[model samples]
Target: MNEVAILCVDDETVILESLQEQISRHFGEQFMYEAAESAEEALEIIEELNQEGVKIVVIVSDWLMPGMRGDELLVKVHQQFGDITTIMLTGQADEKAIERAKREANLYCCIHKPWRKEELLKIITTALESV
Candidate 1:
């Protein structure tokens, strides 16, 4: 997997845009950011990019979504792309979901809603470095 690629998935358009803007603003051209509004869309992007021979480094997803929750989507991602790091961003996540994600998806970390840009950037940088 390419280490400079980042994928972000969230159903909320505003949140997704904010993520893209914040990550870009903080890191500049250090990493490429790709965003999707849903798990289905994210999977399609993954497949398309994979066919183009590009590997993604990480996926930061929202925990609460319209269809597949972040944990479920991460699990599916882990199934197909085990080496890619995964993080969940959510305001409504519970202990059970965290436990499941940790075990099944090997989720690298969780970021709470309304995240601070610096803190979120640090978390992602750390996660990427460790992986």
Candidate 2:
């Protein structure tokens, strides 16, 4: 079986870079990490990757995005692709947003900003194990 690929989306380039670097440092070559600057770009990349038969097992998205928020993106992704795990990464997500994601999306977990490497690894490992 192919290794689990992870897609992380954030509007801020700095945040995106940090996530990519931290996740890579933690997991090494165990996961295929891909980052997108926005939900639109992320959706496009997901489509392309899916077409290539490179299944993305997890998606970590920021809640406060420019266009579609992380909750919306995750809900949409879950609707089309049921097996892809969705995790929200945000400094703070409102109650309404969290409720929506919980109802419509299969949220693995929410990781706050300035996350610790160990916590992120544990979440990823657990999420993958559930698959």
lDDT of all predictions: 0.88, 0.89
TM-score of 1: 0.93
Instruction: Judge candidate 2 against the unseen true structure and give its global Cα lDDT, from 0 to 1.
Output: 0.89
Model 1 agreement with the true structure over 1-131: per-residue lDDT tens digits = 33357899999999999999988787787777899999889999888878877788889999888888999999999999998899899999998998899999998889999898888889888887887
Q: Evaluate residue 27 in candidate 1 and report its C-alpha lDDT on the 0 to 100 scale.
A: 71
In candidate 2, list every pair of residues with a backbone clash. Answer: none
Each model's number of backbone clashes?
0, 0
Q: TM-score for all predictions?
A: 0.93, 0.93
